[model samples]
Target: MIRRRAFLATCGALGAALLSRRAIAATAEVLASLRSARQRIRTLQARFEQERTLGLLATRVVSRGELTVVLPGQLRWELLPPDSITWWITPAGLAYASSRSRASADRSAAGPMAGVLDDVLVVLGGDPTRLEPRYALEAALQPDETVRVVATPKDSRISAVMRSIEILIDRDLISPRRIRMEESSSDRIEIRFSDVRINQPVDPARMRPPTEPRP
Candidate 1:
C-alpha cells in the first residue's frame, strides 16, 4: 500500500509539470502570432471610447476619441468636442493642444505625464515585440477567438505608476479590440476601439504638429 501511494504521488507531480509546460507553450504561441499580425500594419485608424476612474476622487469620466497612426513613428489622438484635446506624437517628440485654451504644449512642458503618454502610444500600437523589452507578457486564447495579453512593466519608472496593462486582440481582425490600463487598485483607464481601418490612407495634415505657442 505504501509503494502504491508513492507511485500515485509521483504521477500526480509529473502531470502537474506537463500541464505547466503546456500553458507556457500556449502563451508563447499567442505572442508569436501577435507579433506577426502587427508587422503587417503600416497605417491604422480607429474610434475609441475611454473611461477613466480616479481613485482619490472616486469619479468616473468617459470620453470619445479618434486615433490615427502612421508607422515608423507618427500618431494623432484627438478627443472629440465637449472635451476637445489632441495629442500628436512624431519622431520630433510629443505635443498637445486643447480646444478650450487654443494653446499647444511641447514635450518639455508635458512633465511627468509625458512618459505615461508615451507608454500609452506603445500600447495602442499593439506591437508585442516593441513592448516585450519593457514588459513581461503573458497571453491566453479566449473561447471567442480572441487573444488576451497581460503586460506587467519591468521598468521601475513605469511600474511606479502602472500596475499592469491588458489588451484584447481579435484573432480574425488581427488587431486590438480593447486595452485596459490599471494605475492602481482604484484608479484605472479602459479604452475600447471600434471601426478600425487598417493600412488605410490618412490625411497628412491630420498628423501635423500644432503651431500654437507652448504654455
Candidate 2:
C-alpha cells in the first residue's frame, strides 16, 4: 500500500508539471501573435476616457482625451478642457502644456519619469519585444476573444512607482481596447479607447508640442 501511494503522488506531480509547461507554451504563442500584429502599424489615433482613483482621497476623477502616435517614436496625448493638458513625447524629449503652465525637459533631465513615459509608449505601441526587456509579460486569451496581457515592471525604479499594467487587446483590430495602470492597491488609473483608427495618416500638427501663448 505504501509503494502504491508513493507512485500515485509522483504521477500527480508529473501531471502538474505538464500542465505548467502547456500554459507557458500558450502564453508564448499569444505574445508572438501580438508582436507580429503591432509591427504592421505605422500610425494610430484614438479617443480615450480615463478614470483615476486616488487611494488617499478615495476620489475618482474622470477625464476625456485623445492620443496620436507616429512610429518610430512620437506620441501626443491631450486632455480636453476644464483640466486641459497636453503632453508630447518624442526621441528628442518630453514636453507638456497646461492651462496654468508649460514646460519641456530633455530625456536625461526627465530622470525616472522618462522611463515611465517610454514604457507607456511601448505598451501603447503594442510591441512586446521592446517591453520584454524591461517587463515580465503574461498573456491569456479571454472567453470573449480578447487577449489580456499583464506586464510587471522588472526595473526596481519603475516598480517603485508602478505595480503593473494590464492591457486588453482587441483580436480583430490588433489594438488595445483598455489599459489599466496600478500604482498601488488603491491607487490606479484605467483608460478605455474608442474611435481607434489604426495605420491611418496622423496630422503632423498633432505630433507637435503645444505652443506657449504670445503676449
RMSD of 1: 3.6
> What is the total number of backbone clashes in candidate 1?
0
Question: Model 1: runs farther than 4 Å from truth?
Answer: 1-17, 102-119, 212-215
Model 1, global lDDT: 0.80
Across 41-113, the per-residue lDDT of candidate 1 in tens digits comes to 8888999999999989989999999989888578888999899898888655677788655444556775545
> What RMSD does model 2 have?
2.9
Error of 1 at 80 (Å): 0.8
What is candidate 1's TM-score against the reference? 0.82
Which lDDT tens digits does candidate 2 get at residues 114-200?
Answer: 878778877887577578888888888999999988889899888878889988989763778999999988999999999989999
In model 1, state the lDDT of residue 72: 57
